[model samples]
Target: MTRHGEDIGRWLATQRRDWDRLNEEQQARLGKLGVKKAARARKAPAKAATASRQGKGGEAFQKGLEALTQYLARESRMPGRAAVQEMPDGDIRRVGVWLANQKQRRDRLHPDQLAALAHLGADWAR
Candidate 1:
């Protein structure tokens, strides 16, 4: 919804998000408009959350590497950007897309991750 060139939905979302920062008069005005403050979301501790995410990401990367290894063994070459392959374990992976994404984000990868891919003859991974 729009009102006088302002996006009402987006404005309401922003108002709710910044509810705590609103002065009493502002809050009253919004309250009259039936725009309530948004509920605060609970979050895990940063260290634990980061560690958990890292663990999951590492596991996923290992799975992708395994899929890539099997693909290399069969095709004797890297998969193209649009190629998809079935792993020995029967998982269908878009290995080519995965590789492309990895190559694009190589700068963000850990040294060990880059080394692993480089070892697999992925020159771009180096």
Candidate 2:
């Protein structure tokens, strides 16, 4: 006779196709036979979580900008240079260059970054 495992595997292949077409109540019936309903797919987080995450991201970006500002002020004696050299992290240096290229100090940051700065109650303009 055929092995039980092989029989179950064969049965599952056929059942899986029908599983997709089955209604919730029909799918529940299959659970009694040791066939679980397929786990529901994962979904994106709710709007509140997204907003909270963005808020946190903005705070982090602002902190990085502030630190870069302080480092440039102390080491380079210039806040806005077209190119910054010899910084440890390349990303930080790139941000410094971008900041330096800004025509106005207030225009240095992205809108999201500005929003984040405001959210943290920081007045960088002073």
Candidate 3:
């Protein structure tokens, strides 16, 4: 089911994952909906999933870095939010949109990712 265009399944999954952080009233409300807290014994698997996701994030960051570097090499400056770059492998990456997203999500970025962006002269990354 969906609410406000967001999938209830995904929302419930998040709620389960963060169940321990929820207030008593919130937990009770979810309990009424038949949602239970995440299993404590499952933490090891959760950590493994997080590691897998971080690995993928690292790969994506590398691709974004490649796109940005290629753009900079050709243009001598960062691309604007509307700029798109054709990667060497023929993949068209929206480098500008990626950069803009990075800036907006800078606070959530890994320290290494932020460092890479800062090294590339993205002031917002700092």
lDDT of each: 0.83, 0.52, 0.83
Give lDDT tens digits, candidate 1, residues 1-126. Answer: 899999988988879977998999999998998989998544335334534565777787888898899889999999998888897678899999999988987755666778999999999877
User: Model 3 Cα RMSD, Å?
Assistant: 6.7
Write candidate 3's Cα lDDT for 1-80 as tens digits: 99999999888887997798899999999899888998755445644554457577768878999999999999999899
Clashes of each: 0, 1, 0
Per-model TM against the reference: 0.56, 0.27, 0.57
lDDT of 2 by residue, 1-126 (tens): 247546766667547645877788767778777786455433234323434565765465555566555565566544445444344544445445544433243433454555654443345633
What's model 2's TM-score?
0.27
User: What's the lDDT of the predicted structure labeled candidate 1?
Assistant: 0.83
Which of 1 and 3 is the better model by lDDT? 3
Off by over 4 Å in 1: 1-54
Q: Relative to the unseen true structure, what is the C-alpha lDDT of residue 68 in candidate 2, on a scale of 0 to 100?
A: 57
